[model samples]
Target: MQGITGYELSSRKAEYLKYIHMQGDVVKTTEIAANFSVAPSTATKTLAEIAKAGYIEHTPYHGVRLTPTGTAYARFLVRRHRIVALVLSHYGLEPDEACKEAKKIEPCVSKSLTDRICASLGHPMMSVCGEIEHDCCCCCPSGDHET
Candidate 1:
């Protein structure tokens, strides 16, 4: 598809993007491998695949960096996850527990579904994980965020 990341993206892929983006610098193969508990080779292979999809730049044995497309997708995924966690917390799940549940739930959340949820939640400004902000187009037609 021709959306943010240019494909029918996976949340697992989204997770990788978010992790890399959060690092605020090039993320080494070793770091990603350790964080995800996978062998370095496995992490390399995964990174290569995403790179092929054009959301990141990966250099073998070196590190990975997000493309602009990757950044937009990561932001969207984070927003979706925070919203899911927030809603679950309202059902009595502890913040941490809700975050955990949200991880499992994030992969299946579609854009329209996310829009509905974010609206229902009254566009909450913070979540257990920290500040929550949606991709401007997700709901904010004006593309404005409070700074």
Candidate 2:
């Protein structure tokens, strides 16, 4: 949790983090609000909570940036999102549709389950959107997160 959020992350908060990570640098507050279709004030409130958790550095007028820990967690979320999308595709959904559906399922998936999924997906290099990075559990021996 310390490496991820320092506490349990709400699925919505995770999505916000995902968006910030995709931005790849200091992300504008307006961009976050627009991406999530939420009001700027709403984005501000949510971001304030996430920033309080230490996942991002937020400045009132300057937007936000992911902390190193945030980047690590976002990678894991992205991996799960893509993998779940791939699974949805097997059910005849279009890649784009699958990606949408995956969003609903991704946050609930546990790390162990995600590993099983990644394996079954043959450790894919890319999903519909773009690249996928393996999390430590997926890369470590026997799927262990702890060294």
Candidate 3:
């Protein structure tokens, strides 16, 4: 209930956070459930747990949104996931396949590793899927820097 702290995030919570970052803004439990092929109740329960952890906002029946802290964490995960996808694609995997592989690998990667991978990828700006890359450059780099 304290949310995920110091490596306590379950795979499901990580997935949910990634989904929220991918979707942007607020998302409904049903939408989240459908994305994961889980029951709405399951999504609701997960959301409630995350909310208790201070990583999300739940407004009874309106929907769910990430709090600032949650958004920062979710963005961190998304950036890492997309960078992994970009690096994997460079290694010759098809775009879609690379994305799937990145999703599978993202959680296991540390922030430091993700930062190094992003740098190694030349600070890619977008994933092969057309989604924006979630890296430090995207957040803080000047336009003069090469992607």
Best by lDDT: 2
- Badly placed stretches (over 4 Å) of model 1 are 1-7, 142-147
Top-TM-score candidate index: 1
- Candidate 1 or 2, higher lDDT? 2
| Model 3, runs deviating above 4 Å | 1-8, 131-144
Question: Ten residues in a row with the worst lDDT in model 2?
Answer: 138-147
**Residue-pair clash count for candidate 2:** 0
* Clashing pairs in model 2, backbone N/Cα/C closer than 3 A: none
State residue 23's C-alpha deviation in candidate 3, in Å: 2.4
List the candidates' TM-scores in order.
0.88, 0.85, 0.81
Give the whole-model CA lDDT for all candidates, comma-separated: 0.78, 0.79, 0.74
> Residue 62 deviation, candidate 2, in Å?
0.2
For residue 124, give model 2's deviation from the true position in Å. Answer: 1.6
Instruction: Evaluate model 1: give its TM-score.
Output: 0.88
Please state the error at residue 127 of candidate 1 in Å: 1.0
51, model 1: CA deviation in Å? Answer: 0.4
Of 2 and 3, the candidate ahead on TM-score is 2
